[model samples]
Target: MIRETYVLVERELKKWVGRRGTFFISLITPIAWLALFGKSLNFVNMFSSAGLQGANPVIVKQYVDQTLLRLFGTTNYFAYLATGMFVVFAFFQSVFGGVNIVFEKRLGSMNRLRMTPAPRSSIFLAKMAATLVRTFFYETILLVIAVALGFSVDWNAINFIEAGAAIALLAAGFISIFEAIGFAVDNQEIMFSIVNLINLPLMFASPALFPLQQMPWWLRDIARFNPLTYAVDIVRYNLLGVHSFNILEDWAILIAITAVFVTAGLLASLRVLENY
Candidate 1:
């Protein structure tokens, strides 16, 4: 399984690398999101302009930092927002990761692969593995952009590892389901429609773009079941020293949910393949 998966994975990577225009173009969205969204909501400026001008300069500075720290867990809002963006970007990327499978199937590449003696599981695992590689690649770039734009982090190797693990776990869970959808569907339009349907609801309902505390009670309840919520919380805990949920509980819940998703997606994909 490992060897077969490797060969198939190599094919995916080669295709990815060969499409230099696509690879570079794909990066533009995340970069623009990180740049504009990260900088536009300048909370400090908002508060600073709210009438602290006559106060002692040092006192005003301290008050502003303290208020921001109380609300955002950091003196900088960008740091808090950026940490969440890490998870959000990965979430969106993984949601579309399986689109390649739909395309390959449309182009007849999937049919050709099915004719080979390769294990069916290898086809599934190879697509998932390649998606993971792309996810991590984009994540690293997002982190660099976040830091360059005033997103402060722990800067510890352990924090990076923890954040990465959370991202991987989250991506794997999402990729699994979408990959199954890709394999089962005959039309790319259906796969894309499903992606669009779930993408924003999942993102908005979670604490990916805002603090959980700030959400409405019903929304927060919904976010409780969102893997992105746990992912964002875990990433925030590791990177920014602030988080909405307990780390241990977050990990446990995330692991359980991912296990369910992965198991179900695998069974579904294999069952569909059996019809071929």
Candidate 2:
């Protein structure tokens, strides 16, 4: 199984490399977020002001010490925003990859592949792997830039490993959900439209730019229920060693969501292929 998976992954990687334009375009979103959005996210103090004012001075000091200042290992607000931007980029890549799948289906590539002797699971796994690799590539480039810009992180082996695993899991879950949508949709344009429509809202609804505790009560509740929130939280924890909840609980929720979404994607893709 491992060998077969590698073979399929290699094939997908070749295709990805061959499409230079597509690959460059994929980097644009992450670059824009890192360069543009990262600058605009300097309102962290404003966002946290209300919560800070309402809390006891000592408690506020502790919160700032534990979360914003100490947890991130830096007092720079941009570094904190960079962590959230990385998560957003990962989720966006996965969701956008689903549109590519829909395009491939419309182009009849999916049907041609289906008629081949290759295992169906191999194809699904290959797509997921591609999404993961692409996301990692884009995010790593952004991180390098962030580091160059003076964003300091704990350069430990454990943090690096955890960050990679967290990103992979988050990408897998997001791709799974979007792949299900691709299976259900018949048109590439419609799929693209739907994905873009949800993109901004998902970012805004999550704790991407600021902590959930800083949000209004209604928004905070909504963000708490968002899977992207968990991904952002875990990434922040891994990158900065600061967490909003128990580390074990965050990992469990992320793993569970990945499983559910992967299962749903497989069922949906299989049903659609079978009918085709």
Candidate 3:
């Protein structure tokens, strides 16, 4: 199984490397967010320009700190925003896990592989592993861009290790969910449609680009149940020295969610393969 999974991982990586343009384009979303949106997000400026008519500077300062900085735990909004981009990049990579399988099916590659002695589980594992590796590659690039744009991330070895683990687990869980969706649907268009339906809502509802406290009451309630919210909090706590939620509790929830999705994804992949 290890050998078979490794082979699949290699194949996936090769495909990613060959499509350099696609890989880079996928990365542009996070970079653009940090470069353009992060630097420009300022409610204070907007409020001031709206002419509150000589409001006390101290009151304005306090409002900014409490409303925005409190949510992010940072004066530098870029750092806060960049940290959330990890999940965004992870989601992008994971969303395509099963799409690869669909393409292989169309190309008859999957049929050829099933003719071999390779276990069906191995095929799915290989794709999962490949997605993980791909995510890491894109995430690293995004981090470099963030740092270049003056986003501060914690570099303490212990913190970095813990944060990396959290990221891996988050990616694993999301990848499994998407992979399951891909396997269950034969048509790539339908799979992508389902993905699109869920992706943007999940991103907006989570405290990724915006803080939870600033959202409407209903959106905040919805965010409470979003796994990406937990992912963002865990990563921010570890990497940005921000602890909006209990770190230990967040990790527990994230792990539990990952386990459920991974199990479902494995079962779905196996069932799909049996049919193929």
Q: Report, for every candidate in turn, its global Cα lDDT versus the true structure.
A: 0.84, 0.78, 0.81
Clashing pairs in 1: none
Residues 1-276, model 2: lDDT tens digits: 566667878877888888889877877876776678776654345546766556566665555556656434546667778888888888888886688788888898888878877777777777888778878887888889888766788888888788778778888987987877887798978987898798888898987777777778999888877778888777888887666877788889889988988898888877776776
Q: Write the residue-wise lDDT of candidate 3 on 23-132 in tens digits.
A: 86787777778888987877677667778548986787677777666666777777788878787678767887877777877788878988878788888898899888
Off by over 4 Å in 2: 1-4, 40-74
lDDT of 2 at 258: 87
Clashes of each: 0, 0, 0
Highest-scoring model, lDDT: 1
lDDT: worst 10-residue window of model 2: 39-48
Each prediction's TM-score versus the true structure:
0.94, 0.85, 0.91
Q: What lDDT, from 0 to 1, does candidate 2 have?
A: 0.78
From the highest TM-score down, the ranking of the candidates is 1, 3, 2
The digit string of per-residue lDDT tens for model 1 on 194-245 reads 9889988998888767787888899989989788999999999998888877
The clash number for model 3 is 0
